[model samples]
Target chain A: MKAIVVERGENTPSLIETPVPEPADGEALVRTLRVGIDGTDFEVLNGNHGGFPAGDDHQIIGHEAVGVVEDPNGTGLENGQLVVPTVRRPPEGSNEYFERGEPDMAPPGTYLERGIDGAHGFMSEYFTSPEEYLVTIPDEFAETGILVEPMSNTVKALEHAFASRSMFDWSPETALVLGNGPLGLLTLAMLDQTVERSYCLGRRDRPDPTIDIIDELGATYVDSRETPVSEIADVHEPVDFVYEATGYAKHAFETVEALAPNGVGVLLGIPEDWTFDIDGGRLHREIVLENKVILGSVNSHLRHFESAKESLARVPDWFTDDIITDVFSPINAEQALSSGNNRIKTVIEFDTR
Target chain B: MKAIVVERGENTPSLIETPVPEPADGEALVRTLRVGIDGTDFEVLNGNHGGFPAGDDHQIIGHEAVGVVEDPNGTGLENGQLVVPTVRRPPEGSNEYFERGEPDMAPPGTYLERGIDGAHGFMSEYFTSPEEYLVTIPDEFAETGILVEPMSNTVKALEHAFASRSMFDWSPETALVLGNGPLGLLTLAMLDQTVERSYCLGRRDRPDPTIDIIDELGATYVDSRETPVSEIADVHEPVDFVYEATGYAKHAFETVEALAPNGVGVLLGIPEDWTFDIDGGRLHREIVLENKVILGSVNSHLRHFESAKESLARVPDWFTDDIITDVFSPINAEQALSSGNNRIKTVIEFDTR
Candidate 1:
């Protein structure tokens, strides 16, 4: 088996030959199909994100991947079934925080590419994960299974935004999405069905096809480089909801300012540093007094995964092949990652069968 | 009528003779009885708090006061009834955010001594207020009516804490109140029924009677000047809820660190500066993994006033006249303001009848 592994913190990932992972009891050996690159992957490479365990060395790194069940160790998953594995894997013999049906609250352990000394990742021909971590992908969704991770994250953000407050009837009067990256566009797409109007802000101005898709979904596009986000409300009435996906601290402050009174701001992007200089006086006077909410959403929950699956059930009809800008073979992983091809989403294709 | 007036920003308040106010439609003329001093009053006196509408020279300088209704114009208030007036009054002919039943959401207006040109305050022999602003006080709660303002503010803080998240069931947990001022002690008293254990932190030695009351309520006291709060937590477990009443930015940071996982840090005390450096790394980690909450709480809602009235109704039975401290006549208002007698709560008893 061959996989992409990071030698150390702040180092480029390299493809190397590795032994095929074996399925233990209650675990599955997944033969890789596609792996996706995300901001979390970048953080893992830089040793910035807290998702990984301590004392890092050479390790497998990809978490967002779709694979086939090569072996299920009698855990009920049949061979040849497509699945997505959970990124977090709590250490064995840890407290019940992990075993008590809440893996998110569990202490850090051997996360793929994050921990687990010399572990092989899904980018390889074969990888192993706990059977509980695998979610079966429907046959119709296999082609675009790489999107499940990012879409599930968007679902989690929406769930957190709605859960923070009382269950009020949702009226998407207006929404302002504060980025045009892959995650940001997906956020706009997810919100397209809910909000009456949507605005997309991005850096590029070449009328990217993604922006065209957003426009086709009936959202207005504003090039952030040319227009100020603070003036968004002035241009398009006050935004009722703001989705901040820029992962930039300045955009976080500006998004809060753009939201209308009693609006909700959902923070999904994880920046390198957590320092954000918000206008506390303005936030206290306007955001709080106006009944607005600023909430954070990190990773996907089980329910969000289910919701994302349901949301993605329609992707086949809506997303054209061009939406997936680039696809690489497992051998060309470095070129796939470093290519500045205005790629919205790229995938690493593997053939383990 | 005689009143205390500030001519301009940073001007010293002076006793001045003014004409008695007459009740307008839906308004009332109240014979001022008791006035309570607040930190906001200090800010207005120094002309440092921005957003105050009153100019330096002609504004009356009090907000928290109890009075007798001399006349009511069809607002269902009977003459001679005791009432506490709401300091916030919206501008004329404007249906502001507050007028829509969101008092805290209301824009800046003539707020007692902070705004309102040439408006006589409760510091005067007589003053006028809207009928809606008057909160009727039961006859039994008259002696402690002046404390209602401060107590109501505490109630608002409690409300904000509860409103932020349903992360914890407060009844079975421990709470830490940082600061031993009147607000802090009052907050302890309020939480006595809600939390199982209370910890009071302060600098005072030779324990005061309030400390005795705290002890009587089964609360542990920590002298912060002599002992670090982190050490206290080691002895009696981390607090599930922390009320920061020290009015210092550094204390806010410390209180946040002292909170247990899934804890709520309520910032009830207001610091002068809006800009302050907090460790975003710590806050983000706490917020993300531990599910901790930090929220600001100020002023009071109508519900808080009602709760305060209900709670203070039993004060006379639970407390003694000694806790009432000194009662100075309105003529000695300046002396009362300057006394700094370590009084828990001092009231100006007006004789206007």
Candidate 2:
């Protein structure tokens, strides 16, 4: 078997040969089909984010994967079933977060993400996972099921953001997505179905494909260089909802001002340590006086994965083709991890039917 | 009719003889009984917060009042009914926030808060209000109903906080109140009925009345000088719900770290402009990775006033006596406004039974 691994403090991933293992009780042996790469993958490669598996010099770094079940191992799944694995697993026996079936709510030390933290990933020729960690999708979605993992996170973030406004009759008219990356585009696509008007803010100019995708999705494209997020309400209109994916520390603060009264901002970005000056009083006063809500969301629960399957099922086929900008084989895994091209979503192809 | 009014930039309230107001159609003339004083009143007096009524040099300043209807100009209320008035009124006809019956969600410019901003307050011996703004209570509540106005803000804040967690099975076992002023003590008293363990943080040491009240309420009192808010999770257990009433700007950021996993912080304090340094990346990452929620709430709606009447009805009579420490006549309005004495709650008596 061959796997892609990132050694400690390395900026590039390497292909290595490893022995295939049999599935244990309550586990399924899966033949990897495809794995998606995003910002988190780049962070893992740089060794600035995610933890290495205990006592290991390197970690297999892929969390968004779609695989075919080779062995159900007495679980509910069947042989040759199409499945997508969820990322986080409990550190040990049941704690509160997992016992209640909400590993998404688990804090830092209580859980580990496969391929990203304290656990090996599925970017390999063969992988084994507990049957409970796998979600089955229709066989027709073999090309797009790999997106179920990232889409699940979007599902959870949007769900929580809407839930926060459940107390009031919150009908948002406009929405702003603070990034134009793959996740941001996916979020924009999802919002496009409901919000009357939507805008996608990014650094890309007219030459980029993401800007065109934004236009194609029926959303206005606002370049960050031309109008900063804080000035969006002045240049454009105050948004009723803001989906933050840039992980730029300042966007978190500016999101406060960008929102209209009774609006909510859902944050999904994770950034590195950086200190800066801020008008703490003005921000505090704005939120308190305007009835604003800012919520932080990361990872997803099984329910969200199920919901993501339904959401992905609704996405048009042309979108899947337009967003997946790069696909590489194991020999070019490093290039797949560090592509400098204007890419939206990059993936590693592990096996064919 | 006599009223207590604060001129712009004045730190002291003055007792002035104003003309008695008459009730118009859809309006009610009320004889004010008792009016409570809190931090917002102080802010208005100092001219650092709140706005003056249009074209007015001074603003009458009391929003927390219990009164008797002297003249019901034909909406619903009968003469001599005991009532408490809500604070906010829409600027003009039909805004989205008011049309949906949610004046609390109105932004700063959309509405005016009586006594605090852009409207004459209830501090006068005689006041006029639209019938819809009055919430009737039991006659027995006249002595304690003055607390209803401030308590309504608490009801709204807590309601929004709980609503934010409605997406999950959020059964919080621990709670922390970040200030020990009247609002904080009132909040602690409210949480005492549900949360198993509660703590109130303040700057007071031994012999302070608030500390005694906190202890009497069966909640631990934490001195801010000893254990900073950011260290609460280390010295004590991380709080699952944080009620922030301290206007100190830094507590807003410290609150991010003070929360437990899947915790929520509802901010009610309004601070002044102050620039400070903060690790923005750390705060952003902490919120995202921990599934924390921070919501800002101010003012209260009509429904919140109705709910607060029920909450105040359940409070023990002894608490009303213990909380209201000082009562002064209109001749001593300045003394009532600037009592240097140690006090929990103060009131200005405008009429006797």
Candidate 3:
């Protein structure tokens, strides 16, 4: 069997030979179908962040993927069934928090995320996961099922934001999402169904594929490079909800200025250190007087995974074609990983064995 | 009638003569019995902040007070009935937000807060308010009902913080409150009946009256000077709920570091210009990965006012007496406004004129 591997502190990933994995008790063997390459994957490949599995010099890194259950082992999942496995797993086999049904809130160092942290990932010929961690997908979603894992996080972030706003009759009329990456575009797709006025901001200029997707979803695309987030409210209305996925450190603070009274800012970005001065005194006052809530959310729960599939079920099949820009076979995995070809979503497909 | 007036740009409050106010349609004339002076009053006296009523050179500065309805005038109020007049009024006599029953969340410049911004306050001998703005109290609360206005804001702040945590079964077991002023003490008093473990952090050394109030509420009094909020979790367990009322800008950010996973930090204090560099990058990560929510709250709604009265009804009578340190007549009003006495709450009182 072959696997995608990134050496410790390496800037590139390559294919390598590896032994096939066996299913353990209550776990089923899965043959990989497709693995998506996201910004996190690029970050892992560059060794900017994410930890390799302990006692191993290289990490099999890819958290977003769709696979077929090859050996059900009577785990209830049928062979040839499409499924999306979750990325995060509890450390020490399991912890009190995850055992209590909340692995997303696990404390630092107590959770080992597949591919992104201290465990082997699904970017291989075959992998194994316990029944509880795998979310079954509809047969119609077999080709684009890899998006469920990434899109589930967007669902959870919005769920957390709205949960915070349940005290009032909170119908957010306007929304601003501060990114145009795959996650940001997916967020816009979800908001398009609910929010009346929506905007997606990014660094690139107009006439891009991301902008085309935004237009297709009836959302306005704003180039953040020309119009900064601080000035967004001046050009448009103050937003009730801001889905921040840009991973820019300073935009987290700037979003405070763009929030409406009693607004909710859901931050999803994880950026490197880039400090800037802020009128924190004024920001503090707005939070106090205006009843504004800013919450940060990462990862997702099993329910969120279900929500992602439901959301995708509503959109047209061709819309997935707009989101998933390129697909490649395992022999040409390097092009999928290294290409800067205006790709929104790229994936490496594996032959089911 | 005598009134407490703050001249524009002046740092002192003085007694001034004013004509008795007349109630308009759907309004009632009230004679103030007691006007509670909290930190906002001191801040107004210092000319640090506070806006005068439109076209008025001086601001009548008092927001929290207990009074007697002097003239019912067909507004459904019995003469001599005990009531507390709300401090804020709609800027246009009524706005859509106020009409929709959420005056607390009204847009700025569209609302005027009596005593603090753009309206005369209850520090006057005779004031008039619409019946809708007056919250009636039981005769037993006459002497101490003045605490309701300030305490309602605390209730609302807690309400906002908890609303954000409603997605999970977020019954916080341990809580931390920053500050020992009236607002902070009131917060501790409210949490005494709910949370299992509570600690109030303040700069005052032991044996202080504030510490005694915290002790009486079965909450630990932590000297913040000895153990700053940044080091709080290092000493005690990670806090699940943080009520910040210290008016220190940095403590607002420090509380973020001390929050437990999925914790809530509710901010209340309005501080002056105090800025410090923060590892915002790290804080953002905590919010994203740990699913933390930080919200700021200031004013309270009519329902919150009703809730405050109900909360006051549940407490022992002598407890309120312990909280209000001094009450002054008109002749000694300057002392009430200027005295650097270690008073928890100071008030101006009038014989039921």
For candidate 3, lDDT tens digit of each residue in A57-125? Answer: 998988998999999977999999989999888887788767866677676678888988889899998
lDDT of model 2 at residue A146?
83
- Candidate 1, residue A346: lDDT: 80
Candidate 2 ranges with C-alpha deviation above 4 Å: A7-11, A48-58, B7-11, B48-58
| Residues B17-104 of candidate 2: C-alpha lDDT, one tens digit per residue | 8899888899999999999998888888988555788898889999999999999978799999999999988886759888888988
For each candidate, what TM-score against the reference? 0.77, 0.96, 0.94
Error of 3 at B329 (Å): 1.3
Label model 1 with its docking quality class: incorrect
Ordering by TM-score: 2, 3, 1
User: What is every candidate's C-alpha DockQ against the true complex, given to 2 decimals?
Assistant: 0.17, 0.81, 0.62
Over the stretch B210-318, how does candidate 3's per-residue lDDT look in tens digits? 8888888888888877888988888888899999997788887888888988899998887766556777787787778778888988787788999999878766665
Name the 10 consecutive residues with the lowest summed lDDT in model 2 chain A: A42-51
Alpha-carbon lDDT, every model: 0.66, 0.89, 0.84
- Tell me each candidate's RMSD, in Å, in order: 5.4, 2.0, 2.4
Q: What is the lDDT of residue A33 in candidate 3?
A: 92
Lowest summed lDDT window (length 10), candidate 2 chain B: B42-51
Best by TM-score: 2
Give the runs in model 3 whose Cα sits over 4 Å from its true position: A7-11, A48-50, A54-57, B7-11, B46-50, B55-57, B273-275, B315-318
